[model samples]
Target: ILAGYYILGFSIYSSILLAGLFASQTLIAYPIVNKLGIARDKAVTIAVGGTVITDTLALLLLTVIVGMATGNVDDTFWWRLGISVLVCILIIVVLFPIIAHWFFKLCSDNVSQYIFVLAMVFLGAFLAQLAGLEPIIGAFLSGLALNRLIPKTSPLMNRIEFVGNAIFIPFFLIGVGMLIDYRAFFRDWESLEVAAVMIALITVAKFIAAWLTQKSFRLSKDQRTVIFGLSSAHVAATLAAVMVGYNVILGHTPDGEPIRLLSESVLNGTILMILATCIVSTFATQRGAHNIAVKNALQTNDEEKSRPEEHILIPVANEQSVDELVGLSATIKRAKEPNGLYALHAIDNRVDDPNMEKRARKLLDGAAKTAAAGDLYLQQLLRYDVNIANAIVSTVRERNITDIVLGMHQRTPGSTALPAIPGIPGIPGTSGPGIGKMVTDVLSQSNVTTFIYSPAQPLSTIKRHLVIVPPGAEKEAGFQMWLQRIRQLARNTGAKVAFFASDATLQHIRPRRERKAPANIGFVPFDRWDDLPSLEHDLRDDDCLWFVMSRRDRVSYHPAMSRIPGYLEQVFAGYSAVLVYPVQAGATDRYL
Candidate 1:
């Protein structure tokens, strides 16, 4: 970057400053990667580690350049630089981790651990200052040192990220934004040219670096794009370097005017470069991550000839219900598959509260804790949007979600007593406006099986599953899909599965039952589809009624069974229930 700037006629100091600025990129796409389940991927880890290497080199180069320009590059300067750098490394890399580990093990309180982390961050900054280096470098090293101590899924990690991203990071960004000289672009229109040139050079340079990294490391095209996106954004370090350079007057101009190496125009251009790179980085990472996830899903499908991998997404709304939703997912999830459950909290953007995201994280953290208790891994997903259904659907396709597990609506328990009015074509009750709307949107649009689980009691205590089969449901595309999930659910719980269906439907399932679950499953004859109301008499406290319904427009959908939710709440309210909506038409089955 420095060579490119110098070749483009920038002064030596100016080129060096630009190089320093461009070399240090913020991990802006980290949150995106984290949600996409690629946070711990080798490519991501390498990209992040590469940042440390490049930034350290850039800062060291800047230190040398500044020392020479300021007529301070004596032998003493070299000795100080070398010694200070080594000592800083030694303290942060060697000393900090040991202390952090000991402290973390000693301190059981999360609040104290959080405060200790803050203190260590500042302490690192102070150490860097004492060692004649930038405090940010110290802070970065401090974070690296303490990384292992803070497990990504731990509540402490959640609190740390929530506080940083929701509060301090936003404030810092605002402060950086305030420093931008917007008038510089208008008053000196030439700044746009500078901005354009800088943006083009930095973007290309980063792409080249990412491409080379991909080639060298055998990384996929998507991983290469993610690396570029994560490494392209210029923010904290860039701004700091530019601001420092702006303060340094290199020399006087020909007319004896003071010449600031970094002029207002250049500073404004740098700001524009930051904005442009950040935008590009964010979108690029999102696209790359989605592609990689899909590709991996395809690969996994091909590889899973034994047991199928299940990717269950539990979309949570109510904070109180997170445990139930996550717990159910964990219980139902295939035990062998690593990182099986995905917990999503979609915040309604129209609410217009700054703290909503933080609160959402808190909810998800609770969900993760619940999953953790069951010895399960929960991938946390957070999104902000006005249309939550669309957000969820998009994520379903992006993350390759196989099954969706949703909680019953808040009004479900109370509205069960109300007489059932006609609701949506396939859904059971008109009472659950919130959940009904979401369920209808998702089930109709997304091509994944969905379970709207209403927990009347603890899921573990239920020993029998009574599944109601709508007439032609056995012929539906997602019939086998839901059957497989229910089979796994019953198998995992060691519960009996009683299927009530027509003789033909039972016959259609006999082969699969004989091959897969002859002992655990049993079939009962129901000559008429409307006879579902009569089965309520057979419901027990330990029985969880399963309504295996069809999509609204599908061939198997039954108008008579539209009252399933009403029947459950009215007569079977004593038992828990699961409403099974088949995978949407043309949806992928691997992830579920």
Candidate 2:
């Protein structure tokens, strides 16, 4: 009766513990390996190596259980097992290295490396089984040998490991939990005591092993503490080993009993031990290591903080374009002091022509020379086979660029369809204001400023006129900054400025009891465009109209205004207009 109880208890315990062990292995392994100052790839490899042993042990345990159920336990079985273990050791330590080195030399790609490693694992397991040895030893040895042949940074390894962690590992753990019988522990007090004792024994044993290893290596107190704490966590490997030992090493009896009477009891005990150790080890080690690392990091701070300022990013195709490039250089130079400018260039790779590289290199060389001469900073980018808009957007965010400027050639809007006229310089296939669209999109998403310039008519002096169109709403806080830049531009160029407000349509609405005027600014409201006879008189006096556009609720175009022929025609009817869109300073706008 007692023997039967022990067998039943051990079987149940082993099942629970084995599942917990493997689950905990991944959890504990990641953080511990990370703490060892190892690279991510190497850490993952070590964790994988540790878990490989679990599956082999599980298979071994199942074999033993089958034998016990059939009453086939014998001395010959022991002898065969011992021989198999020996053979596996010899193959792993002796033959595996030679084979792995040969395989490594045969392939260079990541996929091949994974195939080679997996092949070695299966081969090692097969050989161990033929010799009647535990397959786990073979699996581990295979891993060690394969490690020597594989590079730590293999993409194949990363892909395989990620898949395993994301899918297989978690599934296995949840399946194990489902198989457990929680009520068994409460009904059997003696069985629970046995499990408790076993857990304690395992814990003490692991701790001693850790302490001895640390002492032998002459490690520091802190290092030793971490090792001891971390190693005490029994994960997948330990539980898998227990299961294999119970099921395969010792078969069941003739009466359909497990070969080892204490199999279930031992398994239960191992599960408890694994859970307790894993929890204690992971938390203690991770917390301690993290605290120390953080303290050290904080102590070494030395760099100065950066001052906040508006930054404009200008993406240029050719810095040698004297008209556009030189104009930009001169504009930035002439602007108020401390203004930010970033000149960017993308190395497009969509063209299959061989001269693509040559053209890109020439353009980059010109940009470098221009930046150097002006003592300005330049950001050069190389993107192969990437979407142009996406590349521009990403670079803008990555560099924290506040505004964007594109070569006029790159920003000119294209017609929806080809014109019927023949022999006319076909719109340059590449010409499109896609960059402007991107800038607009980015501005909508973020508060980044953008400027689109015409390569033909570049701004050389700020003597340009200023036109203000207020939407008759609460004035935005950023209005001052816009005015400041305009004023600075005007001061630098002997330019005159004018402000205009729509007033003609106001009289069409029902009159209110009282009319209030905007504070700090004066406006002369008119009933219609024609009502202001002085408008044409004023237009003749100024060089250009700087139209300031702001976001407001009341600004809508009337049907009559929509049919206005052309921008130049509308301006010629009265005044030439330079439309200025006022945006919050330092705001990144997503116009895309």
Candidate 3:
């Protein structure tokens, strides 16, 4: 407002509009930081939070200014504005998700989904009009809604990002060019003066804001620079403010001319300011990004030195489940490790079926293809042994495998495998029928960490994880190892975890959770293993159930764990579930 009134002697409403334009900023240099992989740094996140606040305030100012220009500014206007905001938020956040989920659940076509998303974007704009807000903000809110339903790794998200970066951003720049009048700047000294003062004022204002944020938050110089760089480019919303102000005419001039809120020179000057700020912002962001990337590299190198080498072995039995099991391993496996995943299919030499060898080869082939898609190398190891479980145990010892991913009970053709059978009275769900003995034998004979997966839905679609950690789980030999693995899963999938464990166990887990993730992880004090069936109300289709089970002879073992197989096969059969069997002391590599 000071810059406007001093430089051009603008009216109160005109000064207010110009100030509003300066208040809003677009993240034009965000790709620089994101490309460097430091976009998640604390400094960048702080800038993002600030952007949310400033943009909202800037748009609010625009609305109020429009109302004032139309002679509608009063207490009733303020009350209506507040109520309208509440109604808009309710419809967008609460109702949009339910309707979209229903539509996505019903429609499987990719093209149709894309069209539906576009339709919703416009629908949000229409609603925003009724709320006295702009369409740009409505589109922004709609995109935010989509973020919750679709993950970063999803194909649909990739397409949306591709089109936006390719088409929308370029067209936006073209629109900016259309708004700028180069001839006006060359002819009128006023346009050049406005551009110079506006550029200086905005740059100083944004830098001061960032510097204050840094001092208040105790942030570093490089972080402050990043915040300033990301917040300097006043492009999209600023242009909106300029155009809106120019169109609002409150009176007429002496010579039968319309007295506009802002002259055309100011509009031309803003374009020049946009160009100057964008260039400066890019260089600043790049410098900050490089510094942060070097620091992250050093930290990662130090961490890799302390962590042991990870070689995961996934024993394949069911051909259909090969992709799911391998995908699970990929999520936990370190990105820097190559040839870390091995898919082993043990041939039962005792059986004389001619088709068994071909089936095993097909299973390994499928697992290899799935691993390749995730940029992982799958070492296919085929072993012929009389006992399948013994074959698996032997492979673990020979390969020095620290972890194993196995399918639950080697699913029978027509077996539902429900627990508490009439004939099988003692812990009936622990073993169902044919392949149950093999799974039990592998667990008893090998002490390596085993993950028995029973998936009902696709792994990518899981939005949350329910982890049931046993009471004495913190005492297990592989406690730290499994904790690190779960943290890695949390990072890769971006899924929130709700851990249900005893107070003692939660105390131990909380410290590590804070240091590693520190967000999206909740601790629930729960130790009633007997009342596991009470979790029916909390289960969702997009939830993954994790049971940190224990070996029967281990310190964390409980009798209620015997109900897991039954729950997976009967009760929680419709949910994606994983039973984790951590490696126990003095029990690993038993055969070796």
Candidate 4:
């Protein structure tokens, strides 16, 4: 408003409407950032956030201006607008997310889900019209509502973005472009002057906003440039405001013609401004994204050079569990470390039949196929050994595998459930001497982290993680690594992690998580590990359980560790559960 009044010498009403046009920005250059694989960076995030908040306010402001221009500025109109907007927001913000989650959970068809999401967008716009607001406003709110339900890296999100960029967005851009009259810039000086002014005002205003944010927050120069680039594009709401103003006739001219809220020259100027800002935003975003990607690559290389590469081993035996096991390993391994994943199928030599080795080798093929489906590299290992646990332990030693994901079978009380390493000989346990002994042998002997997993459902179906952090879990060497893996799992699954730990343990976890944690993760104080039995009430069908246990020697280990297997056999049989035994930090000595 200030720019329009002081610089353009406009009336108060026109100034307010024009200012609203510039306040909102469209994500015109988001494709550039996404293409460069830096869409998840901090700079791009803040820019997207600013766009959502500013556009909502600007759209409402435009609505008000249009309402007044239509001669509906009475007290009743104001009250109606307030009540309708409130109702609209409540319906979309409160109910839309709930409905979306329910739909996604119950339906797994990809085509159906895509159709549903598109329908929601249109439905939201229709709902906004019912509330007497612009349909565009409701569409924006729908996106913000369902944003968290879809992970950026997931296939569903990729499909959504693909269709949008490929068809919908391009078609919309073409429609908007057709509104621009090329002859006006060449033939009319007034149109040219107005375009130049609008372009200058938007560019300068957005740059200043980005600059002030960078200075206040102490961000990098490239990040500041990224923020400016993303926020500078004057589209969507800009077009809406300008078109609304141009269409709404306020009075009659002395010449017996209509006096629109915005003149023809201004409308032409707004489109020209859109063209100029999008061009600039594209180039700026490209440059900024490139520089940021380069810096991240360098930093990651440095860190990887300093530490051992993260490697995870998955042992697959059950044909039905092959995909589940590979999925768990993918969750734990870093995205960059593709070569570190290995799937082993151990043959029991005691069976004596040559066909036993063939069957064992066939399981590894299923693991390979499962890994390939996810675009991951899994080096398959078919080892002939007397004990499956021995084969896993030997492979870890030879390959320097840092983490082991061992799958477990369903068990009833006093039943030997794990058939993968079935009938293995080891120290006697309460769950009999089969799966329990094999699990104990692997955990008792291996210095590296080992994950005992029994998946009752698909990983994508998981909604929440109920993690039990033993009192001294933070003292373990793999605490940071395991916690990071859990965080990654939460991100990929779109599930929140709830940490149940003592105050002292939370103190350690909070700082580590603060460095690079998802916003959805929460901490709860639970000092007594004995209260684990009470977890039956908290176990939902969609919840995954994580028990952070330790080896026999550490300060983190407790008598409760010995009973976890029995609890899984009885109390938590049907639920997805993982018993994580993390390795000590730098203790060169072996446990056994």
Instruction: State which candidate has the highest lDDT.
Output: 3
User: Model 4, 30-145: lDDT tens per residue?
Assistant: 88887676877778889998998899889888888888768778989888989999998998988998888788767755578789888888988998888877789888889888
Q: If ranked by TM-score, best first, what sequence of candidates would result? A: 3, 4, 1, 2
The candidate with the higher lDDT, 2 or 3, is 3
TM-score of 1: 0.53
lDDT of 4: 0.79
lDDT of 3 by residue, 121-232 (tens): 8898788879988777777678777566654433455567777899989999998988877889678699889889889999999999999999998988889899999999
lDDT of each: 0.75, 0.48, 0.80, 0.79
The clash count for each model shown is 1, 55, 0, 1
Q: Sorted on lDDT, highest at the top, how do the candidates line up?
A: 3, 4, 1, 2
**Candidate closer to the true structure by TM-score (higher is better), 2 or 4:** 4
Tell how far residue 570 is off in model 2, in angstroms: 76
lDDT of 1 at 476: 73
lDDT of 2 by residue, 1-592 (tens): 2222353344553444333333333235454545443212222333344345444554455445445444676878767766767767787878887776555444434466667777888888687767654465466568666553332222344455666779867886675465345676887765477656655654665567556755776644444445545555665556556655555434556787756533555566566666677677777566545654554446534311222355656665654352245334333232323235555555556667657666666666666554443334455555553545566677767777644555433323554532222222432221113223554444445444344443323232222353434443124434444444444443333234444555642322212322322122233453333232234555442244444443322233122221111222333333434333345533433433
Per-residue CA lDDT of model 1 for 1-592, tens digit only, reads 4553554567776777777777888888888987776665667888888888877777676677776776778879989989998998899999987787667645545688889899999999889878877788889889987775554434566688889989999999898899886777778566898888889988998999999999998988999999998999988777767776777786797899878767777788888898999999999889888888777778767545644457889988887677667756765665445486888888887788878888888988988877765556789999887777887888888887878999875454544434445543333454335346777677656777788989865554455788888777776777777876766665455567898888878888676435444466788887666556677677765688888876555767776555666666565667788888886454433323
The deviation in Å at residue 223 for candidate 4 is: 3.8
Report lDDT (Cα) of residue 483, candidate 4. 82
